[model samples]
Target: MLPDTLDITAIRADFPILSREVNGHPFVYLDSGATSQKPRQVLDAERAFVENFTSAVHRGAHTVAGEATELFEDARARIARFVGVGADEIVWTSNATEGINLIAYGMSNASLGRGGQAAERFRLGAGDEIVVTEAEHHANLVPWQELAARTGATLRVIGLEDDGRLRLDEAAAIIGPRTKVVAFAHVSNVLGTVNPVSSLVDLAHAAGALVVLDACQSAPHLALNLGALDVDFAVFSGHKMLGPTGVGVLYGRAELLNALPPFLTGGSMITTVTLTETEYLPAPARFEAGTQRVSQAIGLAAAVDYLDAVGLGAIEAHEEALGGRLLDGLGAIPGVRVLGPTHGAERVGLASFVVDGIHSHDVGQFLDDRGIAVRVGHHCAQPVHRRFGVTATTRISTYLYNTADEVDAAVQAVADSRAFFGVDR
Candidate 1:
């Protein structure tokens, strides 16, 4: 439950981009899963960094550089607190894709004997098994696939049930003695399904395998406490959380991060540089090599602050209402079939569906003409699409700024698309 005075109308006013028009109609942004629109706070924070305190961080002696470094570290601390992890465990990556690749590449380095004992724990070898699920986004799936190919390890996937939910019963049988790693999504970006993470984490731990969570969708929509989840590592994109692009957060257990070797190494991540011999810095800094996204990090911290002020729980409740409304409206349309669980009970605000006789691209283009923005494609989880027996789908995802009326508009536009294509009554 949430407070009655959530004031969603006021919340929608904060995003300036929402006021724009498309094709002679007001914009209806239902593609939040692709990327959320930035709030004024996040935008102003980035601008302020460039205008007032722009300097190279962690490698300069000047006043501006010191101030910049202080701001950067402070932002790190803020994000750490938001995710319920220690500041030292948070590493800034380019995006969730880079974060997942970091772990995959680190394990590959260890397997090649480039890293010491700390990294060896992560190393996958012949006969070792890496477990993932069919519902995983490619960011979570492809990295482990490449890692398996590199280390000669076998990759296993937990299949989805008939209703598009994870088949945990099958997972129990698959994650066995040889399993070294289990990576999956906390929430399905296309399906909007909330995974049973705690149970999955316990199962992976029982098999002595480390768990990595793709929290790209969940972190922005749900209340996340990584410490309580007991995951070894989790990754999420800043752009999807109302923050600026080119910045993401990787949360790893402090001990595990300290043990794993650096993924990208060069300038600024080293202790002392020499031609032949150089030692790396500690966990977070060592993982973040070269120049970092300083301003974007600061802006992300502001975005976190903004979300906190609005209250994550309230946002969740609001989005849940929107999800229910959207689901009901879409269900009323003939020839429309939602890909994931039809009920909104265990799902978020995102929903992907296919029309009986229209191509997804045609559906999307028709919606665009009516000023409704929706994602049209596989949404990067091709296996899930395959599970649903479709090559692609039209996804309508919502956020705090979305309204019940907008959901109605999107549903009407979808219905109009069907009629325009002569595929419906």
Candidate 2:
């Protein structure tokens, strides 16, 4: 249950854009899976940083530089606390996509003999296996595929069950001694199914394979304890979590980050530079190449503060309530087919469904006409959509500011869409 301390009306008031009207109709924004709307507090945080301390972090010996650097590192500590990790365990990146790619390419570098003896554990050969699930976003899938192609390692996938959940039963069979890594989504963005991260972590660890979590969907909605999760690495985007764009996080076990080779090099990330060779700094700094996203980092820290203030438990209960209502309401609508777990299964606050005899584009447009914004397409998990025998789906995703009434409104729009497109059964 949402705690009394959290005033829903006040929380909604913090988001200035919630009052927006689309197509002259009351706007019902449901594309939070793509990017969450920022509250005024987050916006103010960024604005304050830019207005007061607009200087490059860790670059100069000026007063503003020191201020900027302090703010930047402070943000890191806050984010670290939010995710249950140490400051050094978190690496800053442009987004979670880059975070996953960093690991893949670093492993690629390791295979090509880059980080010396320390990186050998990351090395994979033709006989080695890289396990992923069909539910992975393209960001998670493509990088590993590229790594496999680069090193001659085979890319193996855990197929989806008919209910759109990962077939973890195959883990014991497929993830064997030769498996070097197992990467999977913590929560399905399209299907809304929250995957079993702990069990998957155990399975991967038992096989001596590193567990990588794509926590894009879970990090914002769920309480994430990456340390307790015992995963080798995890990545999530700031934009998806009521934070800024162009900033994301990569969390790794400290020792693994020490062992793993750095992906991007040069500038602030380096400890020493010579004409012939360069020595890189430790984990967080080494991964943060070039100028860092300082103000955005501050904004993200503010977002962390916002979520923390609301309490993750309350947020989860709120989302679960909304998700349950969405599933129930959408399931009852004629000609609607929800793509994930439908009955008595816990899921995140997103729902993807297809209308019978209608193109997903038409469905999206119909909803748009009603001032309802939804994501329509494979949603970067084409393999999962393929598993569902769907080329596309209309997705309605929720965030902390969303309400049960909003869910009902979105459902009504979806139901009316079938009639508008002449796809009603």
All models: lDDT? Answer: 0.91, 0.89
- Segments of candidate 1 deviating more than 4 angstroms: 1-5
Question: Candidate 2: TM-score?
Answer: 0.98
lDDT of 2 at 61: 96
lDDT of 2 by residue, 345-391 (tens): 76898999998988888888888887888999999889888888889
Best by lDDT: 1
- lDDT score for candidate 2 against the true structure: 0.89
* Pairs in steric clash, model 2: none
Candidate 2 stretches with Cα past 4 Å from truth are 1-6
Error of 2 at 6 (Å): 4.4
Q: What is the per-residue lDDT of model 1 for residues 1-425, given as tens digits with 9 covering 90 to 100?
A: 22363687788889998999999999999998999999999999999998999999998999999999999999999999999999999999999999999999988888988668777788889999999999999999999999999999999999988777899999999998899999999999988899999989999999999999999999999999999999999999999999999999999998888778778989989899878988988889989898889999999999999989998999898888888888888899889999788773498998899999999999999999989999999998899999889999999999988888898899988988877898876
Q: How far off is model 2, as Cα RMSD?
A: 1.4
